[model samples]
Structures are given as C-alpha cells and as structure tokens.
Target: MGDWLSYAPSDFLLFSARTYYRLFELYNRAIWPAQILALLLGLVILWRLHRGGARQGLVVAAILSGGWLWTAWCYLLGHYDTINWAARYFAIGFVIEALLLIWTGVVRNRLSFQPYRDWTSRTGMGLVLFALVVQPFTGPLVGRDWRQAEIFGVTPDPTVLATLGVHLTVDKRPPWGLMIIPLIWCVLSGATLWTMGSPDAWVMPVVALGALGLAVYRLSSARGQSGIRHSEDS
Candidate 1:
C-alpha cells in the first residue's frame, strides 16, 4: 500500500494517477479490504442515521458514494484534475457523517454515543470559514506554487478562459477558494476514520460539537422569532 502520509499538494497531479493505478492494482488482485472498509463504514453510518430518523444521512450517503464514484470515473478517464477535485468532495463526507451523528445520536438521544457534536460542528464551520477568508491569501503556505502561465498551458481560447475561471474559483487561490482546504480536511478525516482505526476519532467528534453549536444558534434564532410572534398575537 502507498504511504498516505507522504502525500504533498504539489504532487496532486501525479498522486492522483499513481493512487488510481494502485487502487486498480488492488482491485484486480481482489485485495480491496481498505476500499471495502471505507464503503462499509459509509454504509454503516447511513444505516444508523436512517434508523435514527435523520434525513441528512441520505444526502450524506449520496455525497460520499457519488464523490467516490466520480473519482473512479475521473481516474478511468485520465482526468487528473477531476480526480483531485473529487478528493476534496470525498473529504466532506466526514462532516456530513458528523452532522448526521449529532442530529440523531447527540441532540435527539437516539444512540448512546459521546457528546461531541457541538464541537465537531464548530470546528467544521471554523475551518470552512478560515478556508474561505484566509487560505487563498496564504496559498503559498501550503506549497502549491504553480505559476499562472504554467497553469494555462496549451488550452484553446474559450476553453482556456473557462479553465482559468475554474482554477481561480476552486484552486488554492484567494477569495472564497481557500475554503476548499477545510472542506477537504473534513473529508480526509472522515475517510481516515472510515478506513483506518478511529484512535484519532476525537478530531471528528470535535467537528460534530462545532456543528452542534451552529445548530443551537439556528434554533435559538428561530425561538426568538417565535417569541416575537407570540408577543404580536397577545
């Protein structure tokens, strides 16, 4: 198996290719324990969330499954960028899972799980906010040093423009684009929990806690409006 810890942002293009090849090699040998583990973990979360009456679990399952499927397709098509983009999408599966767990188990008390939902939610939101507001300006901090000229190599006129727009919008560039990193982080953590043992599972629990905080804030706002409505009715 390839060393997941050795991956760097600059190697994303080659990494996607090599990772896909490795995954395919594993598939051919019928040694897909890791992939199966991830799939099963996703399914288990979906099942628990569904059983607990959390509607978000369905969306989470779709995102997780769809993202993985898309990544596989991108790999088959030799679209390295698409594969890299899908990696970010896959990362969000963790946050969605955390959200479902919190809604069903923590807030609703449907399961005998730890109470980390609020922290998890907050961490997810904070990371997302940081990615949106800070990551882009500090893109060089993460080592993605591709020059703008090199980025647009050999692409035609309109295609070049569209590609440039996507790059500027989604790449580790400034503005709201930086949020992709945090989004990716959430997914990565989720995948880690799914495939590897969850010794560091507290990281995701913290994220769930953060999300709970956001949910509380939303509920409080709703209650405030209800109070005003009651006042008017009186």
Candidate 2:
C-alpha cells in the first residue's frame, strides 16, 4: 500500500507497460478531490433549489449529502480500501444529481437542452456500459495477461476491459427497468413541447437530449396546468 502511494500522476497518465500499477495509484488520489468537489457542488445546487421552493431538490440533496458524508467518514478513518469502494458508490450521487438537474431545471423550466447535459449523460452511459458489458468479454477477447487500468488516460487493460464488460451487462438486466424514469420524463417533456408552439424546433444532439427536452417540456406544462387548476379552485 505504501509502495502504491509513491506513484506519480504522470506515471498513470503515460501509457507504459507498468501503467496499470501507476493508474491504480493515481485513481486513489484523483477520486478524493473529484468526490469532494462533486459533494460540495451538489450541496450548493440543493440549497439553491430549496430556496427556490423546489420540493424534489430535497431528494437530490439527501442522496448527495449521504454519499459525500460517507466518503468523508471513510477518508477520516484511513480506510483506503473502504474509501475506494465508497468512491464508486459515490458516483451514483453524480448520476442522480445530473439526472435531477436535467429533469427539473431545464426540462421543467422549459429551457432548451444544452450540450453539457447531453455529453455528461452520454459519457456516463458509455462508461457504465463499458464497465458492465465490454469488460467481462476481455479474457475471451485477449489473453490471460489482462490487468485493469486504474486511470482514465491509458488504453484498456485486460482486467479493466473484462470487469467493465461484466459489470455493464449484469447491472443493466431488464433494460426497460433501468430506463423507466428517463422514459417517463421524456414522454412528459414531449407532451409539454407539443402543447407549446414549435414542437420540432430544435434538432436533438443525441437521443438522450431529445428525451430530456421532452421531459422538461412536460414538467413546464404540468406547472401551467397546475396553475390553471389553482385559479379555477380559487
């Protein structure tokens, strides 16, 4: 463990025969900073939403806070192994926050879908898919010399590929189940956009963007519908 800590970021970044070892070392350091920042940013976002009277923000805040707190606790205990394990779980916070923000902020607000959200979702999906599916097939694709790469910059190592493939394939069982929330959000967004003028205005950058846009439109329309209902009730 001490020896692993001695590796430099450059060692992980560069693609060499021993890159896998260096990558493992670098990932340990990298995740801490990223997790910390994500946690802080998520909190700030939640605070803003709460102040703005967004009830759903509470759920986002809770998830992010829990992940951040657990990560911090693991770090303080000097449980590097646990910290590493927690880091992966902490990533769920990132995904959840991103999804919520896209669904609530842009979609609900009827704002145009931006490239940032599309890219993030696509990249995340790709990584998840790679982790779950492509990774497991590595041993069959390559030889037994497969070792996983820990850092992002290096080429796919055998272990890394196998692990990712396996994780993606196993985790995404019943694809419809995994996709239900996003699908509903998309339907709502689309309905809202259709009610508004120009349903076909923007070209979707990706399928995800299209889904997100439709979801947002739906949310905005729901707000409108709710306001009308309140007026009639009053």
Candidate 3:
C-alpha cells in the first residue's frame, strides 16, 4: 500500500495527451456555434460590468450560471467522463458551482462590478482578457493544431480563469464561496496539463495563485477599512 502511495499523478492518468486534445477537438466540433454565442455572452458580461447596474449584474450572473451548467452537462458528464470516470465528480462540482452562482449572484443579487481603476482591478481585467482572447492561441502557438484550442466560456480552464478575473473586479469584496471551486479547479487542471506535457501547463496555476493573492489583499483591505470606520464611529 505504501508503494502505491509513491505513484505519481501521471501514473493514474487514463488518457494520453493525444486523447485529451482530441477530446477537445471533438467537443468543439460537436458544439459548433455555441462557442461563438458564448464568446458574445462573455463580451456582454464585460459590458455589463463596465456599465455597473444591479440589473446588469443579474444578467452577468445568469450568463455565468448558464456557462457552468453547460460545461457540466456537455463537457464533463457527456464527454470527459467517457474517457475519465473522475470527470463525473468534476461534473457534480460544476453543477454545484452553477447553483451557487445563481443563488448568490442572481437570487440574492449581491454581485456588483466597477470600472477598473486600481492595480488589482487592472490586473484582473488583464486576466479576463487573457482567458477570453489570448488563451486559445496556446495550442497553436505551441505547435498544436487550432482544433485543439480551448476558449473561455467553452473549456473549464479558461472559464474558471475568466470567472476569477470577473470576481476580482467586483465593486465590493469578492465572493469567496464563488471562488472556491475555481481555485481548486485551477490547481487540479494545471497539474493534469503538466502531467500531460502541455506547453501551457503553467498558466492555470499561475492565474489561480495570482487571483487568490489579490483576493486576499482585497479582503484585508476591506477589513482594515471597516476597522477604521468602526474606530471613528466609537
């Protein structure tokens, strides 16, 4: 049993790099124009955030909720699980995330966005842009076919990355519960990509960690401001 514990994560992988990329190719082809629509929806979310209204925020939440649900059903459960049984568990997590997004961002309507002004907000916007625009180039730039490209709103990695970015741009303290899955997923997906010998293996972990650091910074700043306000009141 101790010997089994020494096994690397790569040893447990059920699919090859070729299989993983091919899965994405097939998934993309099967989905067709949905990708384009998703991209448009992402742009709309960005516009809403820039405009800054509660109705706009609700729309963003609804769009994000739909994205999570779609990824859970179409990618994880419907496709990835066929090759990797573990993906079924991921599908569940995705679904839970979808529900939480709806509950917190839509039903309760707590989420709000602001124009990027601070270093963190600007950085967050950059991450969001990377996920939406630059991320798909990783495959082709690394010598893989464009067919294997993963886009934000389509694939899990970029989706989570973009979500983290959007969270960082929130006008108030970022949603911690909303971030938990994406943070875990970033590490897990980064490890998986690393084990697969992917050229873009570092992106996921770097984005995740960077977002987390910023989130912590924002949280501390909020707390400090609250303390100051309390002291003044007293």
TM-score for candidate 2: 0.21
**Model 1 Cα displacement at 213 (Å)?**
3.5
lDDT string, candidate 1, 109-183, tens digits = 333211123443334333433322332233234333312111111111111121112212211111122123333
lDDT assessment of candidate 3? 0.87
- Per-candidate Cα lDDT values, in order, are 0.34, 0.35, 0.87
Q: Give a tens-digit lDDT track for model 3, residues 31-136.
A: 9878999889889877887787759768888888888889989999889998999998998998999899899888988887774857888788788788888888
Tens digits of per-residue lDDT for model 2, 80-110: 2332344344334334533543454335532
- Candidate 3 regions exceeding 4 Å error are 1-8
What TM value does model 3 have? 0.94
**Candidate 1 vs 3: which has more lDDT:** 3
Over 4 Å off in model 1, which ranges? 1-125, 131-191, 194-201
Cα miss at 143, model 3 (Å)?
1.5
